[model samples]
Target: MVDADQTFVIVGGGLAGAKAAETLRAEGFSGRVILICDERDHPYERPPLSKGYLLGKEERDSVFVHEPAWYAQNDVELHLGQTVDRIDRTAKTVRFGDDGTLVHYDKLLLATGAEPRRLDIPGTDLAGVHHLRRLAHAERLKGVLGALGRDNGHIVIAGAGWIGLEVAAAARTYGAEVTVIGTRPTPLHSVLGPELGNVFGELHREHGVRFSFGTRLTEIVGQDGMVLAVRTDDGEEHPAHAVLAAIGAAPRTGLAEASGLEIADRAYGGGIVVDERLRTSDPDIHAAGDVASFPFALFGTRIRVDHWANALNSGPAAARAMLGKEVTYDRVPYFFTDQYDLGMEYSGWAPPGSYDEVVIRGDAGKREFIAFWVKEGRVLAGMNVNVWDVTEPIQNLIRSAAPVDLEALADPHVPLESLVA
Candidate 1:
């Protein structure tokens, strides 16, 4: 029931929102479009904020997905420095926090992404305790490094996720003293299994970075309103001038919940529920990117993946659904993380506790290898650490769902292509 010239309102100007705007225009839908973003800057790359941006290797404009001129040229109206206070579902309107401007939309897209989780302990609000999610956060952290010379600067990262490790690597590049603490037994254990995780643990240890595993941070000790120490669960404390909480992020869905939408328990983690075609409970609304937990047809389950690949692919899927085209947003989930000059790629979908066998095909000790997760003789997922080219064959195997020879996969002499059939 939408008018030909109706407006399309996209919430959250991250990758999903910005790309969705571009895709809509490419699809020949020249309707009025508006993008809402709270951040002062336009859409930029988030991954580099944890790596190159922190290391001062890339400029601010380099991180942007597209320049402002691109938006103007495409006739996309951008509402930067604007916050969407509420969503009026009955009226199909979005209210802005400043001046309370209400925008009416014939169709809506929820692309509000995630924010870095914060710690609730005392002294967490201190000046030196930070979370690296936005450009402002990266700029502030980089400034902290600039003031304190790399040799004596101490960084305490509270979580063992990708952000924590990526930042640790960047800090180490500058010869800073880095200490990574995690609640788990091994760093990267949640994603990579125990065996491979032990290798990652050893690799970090080889560098001068101290890894504190199986410990919980109790409090942040500060002096003159700035962080000075990080206290642990075991009554141990470490000197720290800077502290970062890179513990995972949760979906930002306050707007959808306030609009009387059906939210799930995993909503905070996986995000709003949608079908294979990415349609929400209300057919008039569609969601994509990190904010939508659409069913995974390949795994026959629901999973929320926060990665560049997922962000790129999900927008097209949602756009197809918006065009009333029948489509399924099901594909093997993929992601990667960069740490200490290492390029790690993870692909395909794996069920919980589903892998009965894992084949390692290279020297894991040298930081170059590929591990295959196989369940019931079927290749489910593959991970490569510094072994970039092998991923192509593994991806083919996943798509074909072919049976693998365990012995062949474990042989370093045999090429990965041998198992492609």
Candidate 2:
């Protein structure tokens, strides 16, 4: 029943690809759709891998986005465990792995996401050092941590970012002595600013986690093919059993680059430059998710967000563009982190060292607080710790760019909901 002339080839079978395919079908586009994925399984949810799955709170199947039957029912041709080698724009074909399979398409989308960054330092290749990026990685880490048996074993996290901090909390809960070594002066200081970042740092410290702040990990020492200690830039060594390198992620643009797509220079700053509609340098090809650096309306610049909100939203937006109904991707960037019975939610985006003011609502010492970063009286970004419900209102304030009265914003008596309207 689908049109032959309307074939769509989407590369990368993660959230973006899966969601885009579903969105296209939901939009009543009866076209030949082929999804090419490097992984040999159904598209799965990745967020839970760090918390629920890693902690054995959830099953493996619970993390998947779609089941086998759902793909068959929707008429989505899924080519899993296959790698797309390169794209031929002139011939409108994509050459894939081993069998050298080539798929032709009228429209192409590159949702090629990012991979976990590893520590280039020595002993990183040790048997006990792990990076949690996939389900298998989480399962292996859980196995290793469980085998350590709640003793004097230490888990060294190389970064203080969300992933690293989340794992640190998880490691502590699992009865492992967790030591966090962050390059920043404070935990998440780059994103939350020094003020709020210090609050998070204090929270972790109060929970009995050791933090080596403003220290660079130069080398990881190993014993018997396993991590034993991490050497810092300050020339000090910290003892450890397991090492988790969660520094950050790099955009997996190898395929794109091989296909001759213009690679944006991230050194001078800014991510991959896609337009408002998420089109890459080649108009025939498109990209979304962590790999695609698209313009955000709230932030007023091109950003590559490694968050669930952006991954889910950008896919559908790219699908609209493929269908000729272009929509600007201008949503307020939002993210949350759950660690040791505490929930932290962040809304919108603000440049580092750029906020004019930070107004706190609630008690930072109690770890139940809302901090708003105001630039020119407008709420550019904000973070809510133990205040999950504040996310909506604060996000609305960011979207509206509404001026917040300092006194009212700082008052706990004035509901955050009052700011939205």
Worst 10 residues of 1 by lDDT: 261-270
TM-score per model over all chains = 0.94, 0.95
lDDT of 2 by residue, 349-410 (tens): 87676689899988988889888899999988888989766777888888777787889999
Number of the top lDDT candidate: 2
List ranges where model 1 is wrong by over 4 Å. Answer: 1-4, 412-421
Cα lDDT computed for each candidate against the true fold:
0.81, 0.83
Those runs of model 2 whose alpha carbons end farther than 4 Å from true positions after fitting are 267-271
TM-score of 2: 0.95
